[model samples]
Target: MNIQLRFFASVREKLGMSEQKAVLPPDIKTVGDVRLWLISRGDVWAEVLAPGRALRMACNQQMCEPDTLISEGAEIAFFPPVTGG
Candidate 1:
């Protein structure tokens, strides 16, 4: 499936890119799958999207869990957790 991936805040800085269009393998079906797929890309990707890492995710602008189902043209975003004091 084809989708748009977005990175924000420290995640963008760490990854060195903010967004990209991606064509996922048929085995990737959920947000968690995408995260795992990306983690396999290399060390940097693994560090940023690691399973135990603290991050926030969203699908089409609405916050979603790892199990969220994705679709063609869907937008998935990753970012660090935010805090305002």
Candidate 2:
């Protein structure tokens, strides 16, 4: 499936990217799957999207979990957790 990916805040800075359009493999089905696939690229991808890291995700502009099924042409976003003083 083809999907649009967005990175925000610190995540964007770390990845040196703000947006990307990807044609994912068939085995990649959900948000988490996408992340893991990206991580397979190694280096920065693995570091930034590491499984133990604190990150936030969204699908089609709405906050979502890892298992959220992704559809063709869907938009997925990732960012560091937000906090306020």
Q: Against the hidden reference, what TM-scores do the models get?
A: 0.97, 0.97
Give the lDDT of residue 24 in candidate 2.
98
Off by over 4 Å in 2: none
Single out the weakest 10-residue window by summed lDDT for candidate 2.
Answer: 32-41
Instruction: State the displacement of the C-alpha of residue 13, model 2, in Å, after optimal TM-score superposition.
Output: 0.2
The digit string of per-residue lDDT tens for model 2 on 34-83 reads 99998999999999999999999999999999999999999999999999
State the C-alpha lDDT per candidate: 0.96, 0.96
- For model 1, name the residue pairs that clash: none
Task: Quote the RMSD, in angstroms, for model 2.
Answer: 0.6
Model 2 alpha-carbon miss at residue 6, Å? 0.2
RMSD per candidate (Å) reads 0.5, 0.6
